[model samples]
Target: MSIEVGSKLQGKVTGITKFGAFVELPGGSTGLVHISEVADNYVKDINEYLTVGDQVTVKVINVEKDGKIGLSIKKAKDNPKPSSNRRKSNTHSKGNQDRTETFEAKMNRFLKDSEDRLATLRKHTESKRGGRGAKKG
Candidate 1:
């Protein structure tokens, strides 16, 4: 019943908040499972994933000297699912060498694109003449 760092334990959700959920562990000790530790993917709402009285298996990531315990639900899983909700970068590839651009080349392209966008914006704003002279009624 003793909670230690790196130990996995089942706990009950005592309270839920925007930041994290308070879990009541064995031996009447409580731990805070941060929103980020609640899931492998982005947790926009902790309530959506956990609620008061919900049972969860958490891994003890840390037990602070001040008696604060940090727990992680994602690490407690035997096989965690990879988070695919994140946007994948199209600029780089592991096996595709042909599409890879050098750092200098990429910087040059970015600068050129930025310059072009600024030039286009300037041309657009300059062509405008105060929206028909403020539309005098």
Candidate 2:
């Protein structure tokens, strides 16, 4: 089978490097699967995911004009349905109980929080600035 962009093919890992892994595809063609394309999450070391002679399914992401092939292992796998257990963050929703609180009370709370944040920021910036060439250590 010819290797084309978006095609999923089985390949045998021939080498592994810090950056990526080399896989030998069908018809004796080789492709490089970059570290970033190796997994869905961060990949610090390619050895953790792949090893020499390991068989992996890879997706053809690109074919350079110079005949270089870019492959991806993560994209080759079927995408799993999104989990229902994901935590949906409602950052702005103060909730039904907070609705009972008086508008004045909410305003006061916000103002207090804002003032406290401003004070902390001022302190941090002043410490860093050190005010008028204050003793470089």
Candidate 3:
């Protein structure tokens, strides 16, 4: 059976490498599952996720002109659950601070900060030069 992009198929892991896993598709054709496409989280080791001869459902990501296929095991799975421990906090309380600043005020603040930084850099360079003028030979 020929595989097309976006097609999902059941395959068996034929080989595993540090970079990826090789899967044997239905028609005896083999495809590569890149390390990054293995899962939603960071995969430091491919062995942590798969092994040779393991059955997996993969999605066809690409089909090269040379008949090479690229697959994704991550996309074939459903959406992953979000970590409950990582909740966002609103630091700016509703009544504690102004909700918005005027465009002019924002621009003025940015310009002031930039000028201060430039002044500090200029002072640093001048100090490095020992406040000495160029010698007139």
Go through the candidates in order and give the clash count of each.
Answer: 0, 0, 0
lDDT of 3 by residue, 1-137 (tens): 76899999999999999899999999899999999999877799999999999999999999999989999998898674333211111214323433356778768868999999999998888778875464346
TM-score of 3: 0.60
Lowest lDDT 10-residue stretch of candidate 2: 82-91
| Regions of candidate 1 where Cα sits further than 4 Å from its true position | 81-137
TM-score, ranked from best to worst: 1, 2, 3
Report the C-alpha lDDT of model 1 over 1-137, residue by residue, as the tens digit: 76799999999999998899999999999999999999878789898899899999999999999999999999999987654323233434324444546889778878999999999987777669564455588
TM-score of each: 0.66, 0.63, 0.60
Model 2: lDDT equals: 0.84
Inter-residue clash pairs, candidate 1: none
Cα deviation at 118, candidate 3, in Å, is 18
Q: Which ten residues in a row are the worst by lDDT in model 3?
A: 82-91
lDDT of 2 by residue, 1-137 (tens): 67789998999999998899999999999999999899876689889889999999999999999989999998888982223212122223544444356779878989999999999998888888885477578
Per-candidate RMSD vs. true structure? Answer: 5.9, 7.8, 7.4
